[model samples]
Every structure is written in C-alpha cells, then in structure tokens.
Target: MDNLTHSLVGAVLGQAGLKRRTGLAMPALIIGANLPDIDAACFFWLEGAEHLGFRRGITHGPPALVLLPLVLAGLLWGWDRWQAKRGTRPKDRLPVHFGWLYALGFLGALSHPLLDWLNVYGIRFFEPFSSAWSYGDTLFIIDVWLWALLGLTLWASLRSEKKGGKWRRPAWIGIAVGLAYIGANWAISAGIKASSHSPYGLQADLIPSPPPLEFWKRDVIYRDPETGRWMMIDYSPGSAIPDAVPVAQGQPCAIPDLSALRKEDGELDAFLFWSRAPFATRAQGGGIVLHDARFYDPRARDRFSIALPDTPCEEPAGE
Candidate 1:
C-alpha cells in the first residue's frame, strides 16, 4: 500500500479502537501497518538471482510477517520495562500500551502484504520454503472505494471524537469485514483461475483488479511458457466470468537483454526489471519505450520510451 493509504489505515485502526488515547495510538498503529515495507530498503543492495522476487520475498513473506510481529512485541515489552526502570516510576494510566500496541502495529504491517496479494503480483507469503506466488488480483495498488469508504468513516470518526461519535463503530466493523471480504474476493479469484481451461486465461493466471469494478477490465498479465505467449484474463469484480488474451505469436524479443539480465549487476539489474514491463521499448535519446498494453490503442502507438544505459545496456534495443 502507498503511504497515504498506510497512514489512513493506521489512523483508522487507532480511531476504530475507540480508545481515548487514539491520538497517541495513531502513530503506533500507522507504523505497525506499514512495517512490512522495511524490507524494501534491501533493493539498494541486492541484484539478479539473489534479488529476483526479493521485493515481496522473504521479508514480506508469510513466515516473516508472522514471526516479525512477535519479535517486535517482545522487544517492545523489554524496552517498556527498561524505560520504566531507568526513569521515574512509569505512570499507571498507560491505557492499552505494549501488547495491544504491538498487535496493532503487527496487524498494520501484515495488512500491507495481505492487501498487496490482492493485485496481479502475488506475495511469497511462505518464503524460504515456498516461493509459489499467491494473489487475489482484486484490488489496485490503491483502491479509492476502499479508501473513501474506510477513510471517510475514519476521518469522520476522528473529527467528531470530541462529541459522542456514532459512525465510529460502524466504520470499524465495515473495515474489518471489508478487509476479510477483500481476502475472500481473492480466494474467489484464484478459484476462477483454477476452474476454466482457457489457454490464454491459464497463462495470464488472471486475478481481479481494483477500481471500475463493474467493467472487470485491467487484464492480469503473466508469462506462458507453454503457449510462448503473454497471457491475460479480464475478470469482473465478483463474478468468475473471464475474457482471455495472449501475446501475439512470434512477437519479437523486443528485449534483447533477456539472456544478459540473468547475470545481474547494479544498473544491469535495474534495466532487467524495467524490461519485464510489457510495452517498454528503448527510446532514441536513451531508454526503453514502455507501452501500457492494457490501455493500448492500436490506432495510436501505445509504446512509451524510457532512457536507459543509466550507465549502458550492452544489449541491443531491437532484437
């Protein structure tokens, strides 16, 4: 999830709890919610094989998400005790302090991966053991409907905190249920993928995407070694119905650097990542021209170029 959504999730969690200490709770909640992204920092260090799928790899993996929160909880407990012992006697009215705080934070962090799995790219929740990607393909990176509904209720709840707030509980219930339902939606999406035998749909490994839910647009893209085509499936929000698409036959490699990408370095690895994008093409001035094939209009060249050789791409542009 993005920062704004993350912060709002935290604020909403804090306020949803309806504790008077929600003000202090907000920071703890927000930090916990976005905690999983801590692994993103590793992007600067890793490259190639060691780096592949590392973004949502081990750190955001299921095992790590499960273990990290407990570790943090224990650490927070020890810190609280240490702080209390070192200073003047800690006040008794700490409200819901360590355990709940850690729980909230852990849940917050967990939410990132859980939500991320909803998109086309699945998270390796069980990393180290299993890299099998799992996704719901239900939500976009940012869901305005989710944001608006959850955010409005939360903001309203926070704003009206001074007086006896009414919508707060409803909001909490809505969010909790919605998150669970969001999870369910993905399960259903996977079921959809599992059911049909459409060659294109199978290759795309289709999943639902967010926004404009009614249209069931934003096809999911995946590589199909079997068909030697890029597969895509357009899925409606809740319905299992699908429309399949596959890469045109014998499409040029477009990316000349495929073989070289396997041997990754800094800039080389960066270029390798960008190369995966469907419409990405090498621009004359420099980089690749990326096309948004999902929204591509055959009439207008959908290809968008990006300058590369941030240092240099030894690989040719048009293979």
Candidate 2:
C-alpha cells in the first residue's frame, strides 16, 4: 500500500483504545506495519531475479520478527540506559518499557510487507538465510471496500470514538471484508484473463489505484501459452490497453545500459520490462507502457514522461 494509505491506517490505530495507553503508538504502529520491508535489503545484496523471491531471509522469516526485535530492543534499551546514566541530558532518558516500544515498532513495520506478500508477488519472509517464500496470492495492493469501510469508519468514529463507538472491532471486520473482497477480486481478475485470452493464458493480477474512479484494474504479464508471443495487459477500462495495439519494436527501446538505467532507478526497469516487446518505441524520450511477464506487467517504474495537456500521458514530453 502507498505511504499515505499506511499513515491513514496509522492514524486510525492511534485513536483506537491504544491512544489512551500509547499516544506515540500510532507512528510506531505504522512503522511496525511496514517493518517487513527491512528485507528490501535483500534486493540489493542478493544477485538474480530469483533472489528477490522469498527465501526465509532474516527480515521475512518468522524468527526475525520475534528474535530480531528481542535482540535489537534489548541491546538498544541497555545502550540507551547506559548513555543516559553517563550523560546530563535527562530529557534524553530512555523509556523504562522500551521492550513494548520495540514490539510495537516491529509489529507496525511488519504489517505493510505482510500485506504486500499476500499479493501474488510473494515475500521471502526468510530470505538469503532461507529460500522459503510465503505468498497468499490473494488480494490487490489496494481494495476500495477496505478503504471505504476502514477509512469511513475511522472518519466517522474519529470525533465520536471519544464519546464511544466500537472502532477496534471494525478493523477485524475490515480485514474480514478485505479477505472476502480479495477472493472476489481474484475471481474478477480470472474472468478478465479469460476474456483477454492473453498469449500466455494468464490470470490477471489486480492492482489498486486511485483516480478516474476505476474500482479495479489488472496489469497482467505472461506469454501466451499457445502463441508464445509474450503479451502485456493494462487491464482497465481507463487503462491504455483498452484501445491499444502492440508496439512496432520491443516496447521499451533498447535503452543504452538498461542495467545502468535499472540501477539508477528500478521502477524504470520495471516499467521498461513491462513495456518490453517486439514493438518499436515510436516516440522517443521516455514513456510508460505495460508488458506481460510472469511476475507483473506495467512494473513499478517511476520515470516520468513529457507531460500532456488534458489527458493522461497527454502532456507533450515532460509537460
């Protein structure tokens, strides 16, 4: 999920019964939710695309969640206390219950990545150290129903929760609805894949996005099992795929030093990979396009193109 969304969730969590007990818990919880991302280091340290997959790495592995927090928290707490006793800065004194703080931080950071792993991308809860990857392959990155339910409930309860409203339970209910919605989203993605009959006979993987009011959209990647033509699907009513045709040369131009480009910005690589194909990039400079691959299409490239005036991709090259 996006940072804004995560922070919003954190805000809700802050106001919950927890606020009375732990006002600082909100940021800490949000941080804990995304803690699993610590594994992101693996992407840099390990070589090969496969390395990115779950491998029981330290960050994702179950043990780290429990053990790492304990070790780090204990070490930090001890260190902080020692420093405090040695220093005159009483304001910097450590919290007596740093353990709880550590636990909260760990939990908050862990949530984001766990949720991400639930998507088909999978996560190597135990990476580098272990090759076992955990994946539910269920749910889009974002869910409208989840946003509506949780966001709405949170908003509604914000002012009134002080007066009294069952807010915490809603999180559980929101999660339940999220799970059910995930199932439905999966069904919808499968249907879209069937309808497209992609070259690889893919099952569309849904992505959650805001704007244009498109409830659900899938960016599918896979070779047509039959044609082996390799395809990409920006499967959205508002997406480019709806009225698009294949490019002339490989989708992304053979940009000089693609590796260098990728190293410079991975999102560029993701986007280019998704745009890859037998098509020629007629318009030069940089642009975003979708492609079909096993993992994801229309990958997470952040490079911007010349802006258009009215429509998306409408700006003339960096407008």
Candidate 3:
C-alpha cells in the first residue's frame, strides 16, 4: 500500500482514542506506521528493478516490527524532553509516557505490514527469517475507493474533534467501514480463486488489477501446461463460467538459460526474485524479453518487461 494509506491507518487509529494514551501518541502512531518503509532509502544505491527485491523485506519482518517502535519511542521521548528543556512544551499536552509511546508505535508499525500484505505487489513478511514472499492479492497497490473511504472519515473525525463532539466515534466507524471494505475485497479474491479451475496441469493466478475505483474486476494470468505459452484475461468475478481464453493461440517465446544471465544482470536478478509468475518473449534483434504476468500489458509494449539483448541460450534453452 501507499504511504498515504499507511499514514491514514495510523491517524485513524489515533483518532480511535489511541491519541490520549500519551503525549505525541498521534505522531508515534503515524510515524511508526510508515517506519518500516525506511528501506525505501535503498533506491539511493539500488538501480532499477533491484529496489523491487529489496523493498518490503527485512524491515517489514518481526524483528524490525519489534525494534522499530523502540527506536521511534526513544526519538519521541527525546524530542519531548528537548521541548521541555527549551520551555516549548505545550501546557495542554498530555503527560508523556514512554511505555504508551512504544505501545502505540508497535501498534502503528504492525498496521504497515498488514496493509502491505493486502496488495498484489507482495511483501516479505517473514524476511531475514525467510526470504519467501507472500501475496494477499486482495487489493491493488493503490485503491482509490479505500483512500476516499478512509480520507473522508478521517476528515470527519478531525472535524468532530474540533467541535468537541464524539470524535472517537467517527474514527471507530471509519475503522469498521475500512475493515469491512477490505473483507469484501478479500472475499471477492478468495471466491474467485476457489471457483477457478485450471486445466489439469496448468497453474492460474488471479491478480487484483482494480483500476482506480473498479474493484469488482481483476486480471487472470496463466501459462499453458502443454504449450508453455503465457496469456492474460480481464475477468469480471460475477461470471459463473468465464469464456476460455485461447491458451495455444501463439508460439511460446524462447527464454534463454537465466542462470548465467541472472548472475550477470543485477536488475534481472532482482526482478526474477520479485516476480511471481515470470515469462519471456522474443525481443528485437534476437534478444529475449522477460515479463511478470501480474503486470504485463500488451498495449504498454515493454512497460513491465526487461530486455536482454544479444544474450545466448544455455544449450537447449528457450521455452
């Protein structure tokens, strides 16, 4: 999920009455919610595609979840003290409680992975402990509906706070509605997967490709077991029987032996590590084009594909 969603989750949590636990509770919750994404700094050193493999890893795992809050709590504690020493501490602020600050931090930090897991981009939830990636396939990386729902409710919550009304009620409502919306999306994905039947040996993956506000629709990507050809379908879940998309429509692309190429190209190596269902196609000049079925689009040309120019196949390589 995007940082805005993460921040909103934290802010909403704070609005749900967690803000009264200690001084700076809201800041702790909001900052901690986005803390794990500190790994995003890898972009400074990691080139294209490499960040895909580096992101949503170690920082999102259990250890970081436990430790990041401590770091955040310490910083917030220090900031509070610094403010007091400078005679700048607000008189109306609640008493600072290190324990509550850490607790709020942990709660906010936990929300980050939960939301990240809900997206198709995937996350290494148990990283360092395990390099395996987990995909919820429940929501798009950025769901406009989710943003609108959460944003509007949060605004209402803040408005209630300003008017000295029941602010927490609005926040609680937002949380309930948000969770319900997420649950509905999850059920949609789960139901689609449960009802889907792949031909004997072929594997089919239903990836959520909700465009802006159209969350009912999704994309299905599959490779033919017999032909090794890759294809995609724009599917609407309500259809009891989707029209069989021709799997043997075209010749499968010859993919070179990736062992040596993966070792040579850092970006390709990372992309392979991150790609859930990767396939290849013939590129211009006898090179190979690599693609992940989850994000590939014919009209976008090579937008989600990587070109390996003049690369040799290892013996009987290619599909």
CA-lDDT, candidates in order: 0.56, 0.48, 0.80
- Give the Å error, residue 80, model 1: 7.8
Candidate 1 vs 2: which has more lDDT: 1
Tens-place lDDT per residue, model 2, 35-98, is 5556566666654342333232456566667655555456555655676789843573334466
Least accurate stretch of 10 residues (summed lDDT) in model 1?
A: 298-307
Work out the TM-score per prediction.
0.63, 0.53, 0.89
Model 2: CA > 4 A from native: 10-24, 38-58, 67-103, 119-122, 132-149, 164-173, 190-213, 233-319
Top candidate, metric TM-score? 3
Please provide, for model 1 over 42-90, each residue's C-alpha lDDT reduced to its tens digit, 9 standing for 90 to 100: 6578643334346677888767777776666666566566776798434
Higher-scoring candidate on lDDT, 2 or 3: 3
Clashing pairs in 3: 255-318
Worst 10 residues of 3 by lDDT: 310-319
Ranking by TM-score: 3, 1, 2
Error of 1 at 164 (Å): 1.8
Q: Which candidate number would show the highest lDDT if scored against the true structure? A: 3
| lDDT for 25 (candidate 1) | 48
Q: What digit string (tens of lDDT, one per residue) describes model 3 on residues 1-319?
A: 9999999999999999999999999999999999999999998999777887899999999999999999999999999999999999999999999999999999999999999998778899898999998888888888888889889988999999999999999988988999999898888777666663633222455454454567887666555555555555666765653554633233236665588878888989898889887766555466666777777655544435677777642222324
Provide the global lDDT of candidate 1 against the true structure. Answer: 0.56
